[model samples]
Target: MGTTTSGCCFPLRGSQAPTGPEVQLCENCKRLVLTEKEVIHMARTGMWEIEGYEMTDSSPDFPKLKESAENGCDFCLFLRNTLLSPEVDFDADEIPRIRKTYRDAGHQLLFHRAGYRMSIYDEGKLWLSFEIWIVHDATGDMELLPSLSLQDPPKPRVAPSQNALQSTTNLFLRQAIERCDAYHDKCKVGRDPAFLPTRLVDVRDENAVRLVEGFTIVGGDDASSSSAPKYAALSYCWGPRAHADQQLKTTDENIGQHLFEIPMKGMPAVLKDAIRATRELGIPFIWIDCLCIIQGNLQDWEKEAGSMHKVYGSAYITLCPTMSKSCLNGFLFRDPPSIVFPYHSLNGQPAGMYRIRFTRSWIWKMYLTVPHHPFAVDLISGSWVRRGWTFQEAALSSRMVLFGASATHFHCRTSRVTEGEDTETSVSLDDLGLFPLLPSTLSGDKLDEAWKHIVASYSQRNFTKHTDAIAALAGLAHRFHSLREKDEYCSGMWLSQLHEQLLWRRAMYEGISWGWFFNLLDPELPERVLLHAPSWSWIQRINIDYQYIRDSVLPTEPEDDGSDGHGDMSITPSPGLTDETLRLEWRLPGKSGDESSVVDRFMQFRGQELEITGFVARFPLANADKPLEVDELREADTNLFWKWTISGQYFCHTNWDFLSYTSWDRIDKGEFQHLRMLLLSSGRGKSSGEVSPGNAASSDGNISENGDVEEDDRTAFGLFLFPTIKESENGKFYRVGTWHSFCNGKGGFVRFLQYATVESLVLV
Candidate 1:
């Protein structure tokens, strides 16, 4: 915000690079004091406050302003950002001159990449024509010299390679610590519920980085331990079980022995990359699950797992290998990947002017502060995005540097930028930029919606061990609790809408799918979902409908909100009852029930069951996306039977409800098939005059005045029940698709206010 006291020209006309001491002399007092990097960066970002200096706006010409500024002032950077090809054709040797001028002054120019780097781009319309770096001296100040191109510039001698990329990565890591992180200002410094000591790999000095003998957490609260060292954490996919002899894991036997002796040769590529990054970023310590926590000891694993919240939240930064599908894939590429587009000015100068376009998504177009660029979004939606364990890792950490497919992205609670993007574009997270992540500070997020956002994204992810479903979300759940009311966490559902959550069926339930279903209908898939949670918990299912889980009770749309980029996943539930909960006991499908108990599997409700006498209808499996109306279903008066093919001798015929079997027939007597059914209230919520069936439709007004229901609550939610795998296990019932569903207006069902007097039920 400072101005020139002597009214000197920018891009100084003389033969020397402009020095801060000469150009920024006090206008009123005639002092030679200058600003530092921190001050310039702030001014460049429009902060406007430079200590001891007057803050004033400057109205400088684009060409002249670019000529000065040894380290490239914020104003010059902005002009470059929105600069297009000019009409005048001149200055064939401008880049060489600018470089020489700054080289003499001991300052070098740098690009957005790690170190002081430069890129020379060329296309017919806009040459982006040239980029330059000037250095006052090797150890002196360095920055990007003002680049000028009115016509096509000569090609540079250097090409992008490993060294350049390394420079870029190094610069990004440095800026993250020095500029992004607020450090102690906003981080949760309070001790968590448990004092579980942590083992951290001290990587500040890579050569002296002792492992088995790493640092350990100590002392009580910060009040007593004010000088505790800061650290970083890593979130990544462990991949499939590697060869035991090759992988380095902490076992109960080696708990105190060979940990430090673990060689870097045996370390997985993922861990090696993370360690190197930590060291380069200057973090004192790091924590990884398998090495830091004893892998073979149940007691140690349980304690460490419980304290995941504090471990991540307290870290100075978190490194995310967002593009790596597995540890074997590794991270840190040799060159930054990017797609370039060429553009000609629309100012009627097709051949007269051209520009290079590096964006596919505009931040302002999204009508949001956090916008998604198509390139970034595409890179983000990779196999790594589906890992069940990493969901909470990204959410809990205050700051993160996501190393993606081609380039890396940086994000914090207050700001975001990328290695491939201009860092000076925005000063606040609320402004426009090239970030592909959500704001860390979710100012207006709702509790139910937040959980829905988490579930929707988490359900779509892949898990090595299905048992880790809830475990993976432990940190997210811990943080979510702080934002919402003290609602009990049901195995997976919340106690607030326990009834509606119970009605959750897989997106591909009962051979019905809205989009493409990835897995087969058979339950015996390669990735066996070990039954650790109750059958009611989604933790027990696979290929779950990620979208449905976000708003299980609402008619929702496709949204990528939450940490995984899923969006608008909040459910606004209707006020209803929650004084009762269905209690149950369960066992694995193969271990429960006996041959004589096969009938018990067909019917397994334990409490008083009351029927609501509702209408029955069959789902049009082909048109599952569209709810089948009562009129359309009743028109198909044929009796549908669900047959048990695995047993080859049994089938049951029911009117609509998968329950209440009417006829017992062998597979040969009926069409062997998978069927979806629904038992809906026949306008019965109006029996007490709360809402008349005819009046309800008329008031909503989707139907004609003559009383024809055109749009039934097909997309609405309702109570759904399906028999467990035991229905096929005992050899007398049907077990087709591992997933199930029900269709009834029970639309937007907040809770099961009209449940049959049925309570206790076992999945087996």
Candidate 2:
């Protein structure tokens, strides 16, 4: 057998095959690519259903056919793949059964048209599907086929070698960078240059020792020193605790030595791969968080970590090791295309120099290519997506080359290109659900929509330390802040949308226990709250789902447009909604000019809490607000809300394990009369009608004392709270859970609030 020059496949050495139109082809294989333009034309016209060719059980030319199929014939490759699944590996022993089923069964290779793709079937069962296209293989050029919905041709088939893969990837990187820099306006580096990070790994000289050099590019009349140096940022997982020892980091002890030399031999495989990729792209520097940030040094870590937005957003390109879970694994190497089909011109001429691979399937084109938000579909899955810190890193970057499990994908503001494929101009980075390049001119509604999507997705991710949750998201928050600098960031929630942001509920997932809700805790203890995050903020909980309640009626500071008024987003007030009982104020702790530690400085302004002048309704709460002592309450009050009326009210407790009857009995006996529900905001009922008497009725239609009926047309949302007992916690209260009542004319929360006294209180 003689193999191709690329050594990818073996062909019959000197077989005198028929030439031109007289070439030997079986009935089934001949129809597969009968007329190159004919297949392409049929695909364009949506007419794939045809009487397919059948495979005979036995043939006089069986020996010749087997030999032809075994060799590098395109028709034979299709036959082999039809007998089995492509992109899947099978053992030699399993091949007998696979071929036996097809040989005797007289399987037929059929073509069926799907949405913008073609599906192949054998014996009336789906064999495999492919996204086929016609292109000039010699020049890597493609003809525009709008009817077929073709974006680009698949990546050219190459020899299964690491060096080949690397070389091809480097070519792709160069082309992507060149095109993005020249034509993509959204992807270009702005005229006002962003300075490099405080520290960067110098990867300029291949022979020289790599070092972590401090960089500060102050732009001026001089172009070289003024312009930010081209650099790459690496995004990867650090692996589990077992691999902690293998992680190379810059620390206080090694800072001096790292400044002189960062030993390439001692570095992890992922880091080394990133450095190699950066050098291949002709970038002079690269940023790896563990190597650039001084680990274990709180001040240095915080300062660098806080500015992650600038580090990634300003980088020339981010190298994403999406397939690798740990620092020990490298992403540069890849398995070449296993299956290759001979290329033919649209005019039916042999294009022997190049080959094609069925890169995408009908299923992939259906689900992944939909014009919807990326988060709605599972586009990319790996350790990178699961990490909390990487969310901001990917979201902030303008361009990234993701080394995915199946193929290498390049993403920028304007395009998404996969290895061996043409640049897909219709799709953008946001379409992949990796990162959304939100325009700086975004309106309030667009900003809110993007923010909710981000928070919903990011909240589901994992973090090593729960305290790092707010910090991990700070970079993204900082970017949003820059768009609207007048808005104050309150830990996690924005002051401009504080009321609506606080309405997030705990999103539950099957099989995963999303932390239990706690009833009460000692306010004097600092651990009662999750570090600086207040109870009202979603940052205090993971996996929260926000449903914006209604428009704000409370007083808000006018946006300081600062002369240019560049960030003005038109605000439309709700017609009838208002916060009648609550006047909210954010109280920031006094900050001294002298701050000793980095963490102290970071948390100084983040520790602020809400001081509300609102109505604190004294009521005996239900099981949802707090885990009531149910066993004791069941006997004391048969008319308890849980027993008599099952109202369609929603409550999300902050923290608690189990509900007990004791708390209700205690309230009945006046032992726990300190519980209060602070009314925050209210709105007119979604539908206006007199409260129906049926709303107060129990399952048996019997009215109970606790189910008080009232004629009302309003709904209210608030917090369930208990006053602090410790002297150090005096005049303060802790939020046990969230509360909301849909105003039915009977037993309405708005009517209940009418009797409550409004007072000033601080919530911890």
Candidate 3:
């Protein structure tokens, strides 16, 4: 049934388009005739606009049309015309009103000859395009259209059906189930048992499916009931199955095998010690890699790599076999037989009802071949041993642990002979004579058949040395060092030097210490001495003391020269003692009677204690034959000499002795009789063979047993005489006392005795 805008339904006449705001509606109820075009237009525009018609308030159609337009025309018309006009009839006259009302309500009527009717809006006009006509009984009265405005057609509501929702849910469930089943299938063939699924169930009911946890099948026949399981089961059978299957095959092939052969020796005692310690600790597992893995299979090695971290991390304690004598002995079977095995049986016979024979097989089975606890043997050999391929300790010690043997020590043999009857059986031994010899085994030989597969499986992981599995082993070594008592001693500064030497030897030169690593050099000598020369008389006190001490050891005859004689001589003495009859002089080379000569004379007195009671007498510049004149005598200044005298006194306390006094006269021009006589009396004259008093005693006061003094023990003294002549005077006479002394008391004592005199005669 078609709805009309004016609450009426009417048959259109002719092909005329509606004008002047005419709208058709059902006569008995509110409805509107909307053409496809009108509906399309309204939908497209999102708004409805109709031209030209207004209903009068007095008109019967006014209320319905107003109501239809005001309150959702589609719903209002559906209710008023279709629901309220069930038995109502409409006349031809009423049809026009109904159409006009619909038109006024902004709907156009469409008519078809086949009784199809609809409303249409074309261009700027409302036109009758088509109508849906229901066939009527011919006998029934012809009904007129109702004066009701058609409301807008109700909007369509689109919602999904239950089947669709169910279908969607089924799709997701199927995918999840497929994934789960495929997983289980892979796990069944995979080597790792933990990957297998423990529980599986199908949940097809929608509500039950939603409640399903993880991957599940829903609304499917039981797996056993079906000729073929769909989805996951199918996937397991075909899709990408070969990859998982091949992986499984590889895992099975490589599992429990080892690829590297490790040869070691000198390990029996260490192994035994480790075993005993393990037993004592009551540990259940030990992870000695050599025994744990098959040496001929890289697959096993790779698998071990995954669990190595845990294997090492969980270990209770790791024992280093080479750390001590006891450990080494245990590893090498060096211990006494009594300690290793307390009881023995002989020939399977009962001794006093007890057998006393040893069964080698039982021994091997009980101790040698027995596996150690997995977590108790994490200790690994150091880099030095590993790099050198010296696995003796590592191999045997590893056998005591559950970790079979370290890959580095697998297949290793010791020098120790296997127990059996010997036809003089001989076993090759390593350098230490502690390990059994091993034949060469290489990984390259097995690469194609085994190693490649293992490598492919673990290629995704990085195994850089510094950060990989060995890092843990290094840390373990450090911990072991910390626990050992030797750590402190080994870590001490001196010991570190040894460690450095070892490190350099092993790391730098592959275990050799040689001179080629260091640089060296050669050897050479030294230089000479310099001296300052001056007249001996002018020598300072220190010079005098040095000369005195040095010259006393060497006696030599004085040189004869006029410059050292009394003629043209000068006398200078103490300033306060005016004794003109006395003259002071010095006898030495290179001298003349002048101011310079007098100064030179005083210089000779350096370091000597002199008692002067004489006058200053200046002699002629060059008059060897002239009479010497004594001026009004006054004591010459003696401060210079006094300083030397005091020093000499101090020296006497230090064991110096004087042994000689000498005089020279210008008139005699040689050794004068008076000076010679005085010199002899004062002990100034010593023959070349004579020994000085200072030499008679040693510093320690021990007298020499021999009467003659040793050269090294000699000391000496000297007195000098000079004759003065004055050119201005006719005749004069002067006497000067010169003395010599020695040290002979506790230290050395000095005693002075005069030894010189000279007479001047006038020659004018």
Candidate 4:
């Protein structure tokens, strides 16, 4: 190869293609940009590797190019943004040496016809490897490059054609639907909505939401007589300004006018984009919450809210503006600009010939990994996946086109596809969030896996109105209800697994302080939310975790109605318990009177408390490891971060300080034994030879302190109750927290049961 006067032995190509201003390239940096002929010739082969050159201390002043990077050199900028930068933990000082490149403290660059791979290594371990591949420029391949410095933000790298609709985006949508219809047998089953939303926006019109029955397709027949016309649904955040009267919303006064035509120019940007996308996809109607449901009309809102499951689930497809922070932010915003290397010719002459857009290291890092959850990568900077309402919308929909930042992501029950050259990375319905895609025939352990996964994920999300916590999940709960039609939804928990669901604990994370009694660290606890639901329910608080207890936890005892045993059933009676000793009765409001609607029935259920029959045992908080005197405990108040004790197996978790709940001077002996354990169910314990908890004390003289007893496999799960003036027919107690006892084969389980007094209590 001939070399340029600047020692730039590189090939360059010239074309009329628009690109950023040319950047000065060093002699060694010219190889980063390849000629069109070289790219094509190399593309014919499988792979290409180049080695031998190494820049070291003996090399020229490579650091001198930092000034060029700061001034705006693309080659230097790419180096500064990637390998040569110290942004990430592993920092590369220079390019890999010829011999040391394959070993420690160096770097390696792998090339292919399309693009290249850059790997950074330290101490003989691969620290980071990211790929930059060639992507065909399309009408929708519009993305904005990052600002070179704090002061200079670059313009859009690839602008869309003026009159061209996003053909690539439309193609992905059409292909996704076609593939689902043709190949996805699973996706074809039971996903069609039994009925459409009460109303839908006629996308072909600028603005209008009509009754689904009377809606007319744009270029097709009237939908009333035929199977409901397919419609798209818009899933975007309403943002804090959503409730402002300025937002375009369908109301009682304007309902008639809205049915005729909606003012599209005045609508949120997201709504406009959704309508545009739907119209381009040949869908005549789309359902938008603010436009379809009457705002400010309580009855209409509740009625429509109850049917949201069908609205999204039945839609032909859901248009998710994944990166949109709010309705105001349109989905068509430019993607993060990728690094582009202007192609060079064999003569070392450079021009805007081939503006090859290659991905940045950060973008590759974000999308390359299998996300821990649905939209994990999107959630890193976007608000769509973090909102509570959108959670179910994404899960319940039959198909979705997530208009992501860099590329469009398509999802159906059978497959997840991302637009671009990288096809290996895809989402799966088997992953968390797509709950409706799960097997409907799932039972027992499978049910636990599904429900627990949902709860854990949903708990971490933010809800605009705390009241919508359970309401938002009603649709998903209904789907779960279909698996076992006999089971009832109790606020958040199911009546079938009420006992196990009651065992939810406040999920601990790094930000929160969690330590033993002596190391009491107070977390910034939120003001206790007051809801009609019982404290035992997970709905009482967010950021909760649940333990999947088996049906074997049901005690094997006779029924109060004189039944012999729980026979030929999934839930068997444990060896030592009876119906009276361990029973649970759900008191729902609709059971007493006829409820006209599902919304009303669910509202009544959410407001009702749980009635449980179990054995009550008391444990003195005074026996805790860092026991506090009356004055010290009372002064600690709600801020007291100390934990209480149950048995020697482990330190028990309490929702609050039990010591502060009692009247210090009013107690008979000032013992502060206000901590009460109510055993709801029991099962065989996990076999172990571990020592008892430090605070463990024998409640009975007959119980042995030594590990001499037979293998007593009894594990009792229950709630720790605190006395409350709030009374009910059975008993008056509020749930402080939950507990499950472990058998240490040292008579600890027997002692726990011996201390129990059988009683019926209503938890509030």
Q: Each candidate's lDDT (Cα)?
A: 0.40, 0.52, 0.23, 0.51
Report each candidate's C-alpha RMSD, comma-separated, in the order given: 18.7, 13.6, 56.7, 13.9
TM-score per prediction, in order, is 0.51, 0.61, 0.14, 0.63
**Candidate 1, 1-764: lDDT as tens digits:** 34432223222222333221212212321111112332233324522222222221121233433543335453333334432222010111112343343323333332221111122222221112122222233333323322222222222212223331276667866776567534423433332323333677656555655443323444322435644566678888765455223556777776565345555776777778888888777666778776788887887776677667778777777888765555654577532222121112223222111122121111111221222332244233334455667777766776677776435767666555656445422222222122212234443433444444455456756666655777777656656555554554555556554444544444322322211121222245444433434434565455333232222122233232233221232333322222233342223233444622312221122211222222222323332231212221111221222221112211111122222123323122222222323222211121112223422221333222343222432222333333333345331112122221111222221212222233333221
Best by the TM-score measure: 4
TM-score quality measure for candidate 1: 0.51
- Give the residue spans of candidate 3 off by over 4 A: 1-273, 323-329, 332-764
- Can you give the lDDT of residue 122 in candidate 1? 23
- TM match of model 4 to true structure: 0.63
Best by lDDT: 2
**Higher-scoring candidate on TM-score, 2 or 4:** 4
Model 1 error, position 586 (Å): 13
- Model 2 local distance difference test score: 0.52
Candidate 4 local distance difference test against the native:
0.51
What is the Cα-based lDDT of residue 610 in candidate 3? Answer: 19
* Per-residue alpha-carbon lDDT of candidate 4 for residues 1-764, written as tens digits (9 for 90 to 100): 43323235322223432342344565445544444454344435522232221222111223434665666456656644433322211111111222232223323233222223222111221111123231222211111112111001011124222222377767756877887788776664546533566777776654453434333433244545546667888888875543234568888998888877777667777787778888888988888888888899998988877777677777888888866666666777554433554443445444333233222223211212332222333443355666788877866777788876545677776666655323322233235532233432334445655676577667766776777887788777766666677788777777777666676665432222111211221112233433445556666366554422332133334433232222221222223321224678877644655564667544444436677776777875555454222121121122222333434333332433223323334434332376578776556543332222222222212134553434554656667775554233335566766665544433234546777787777765
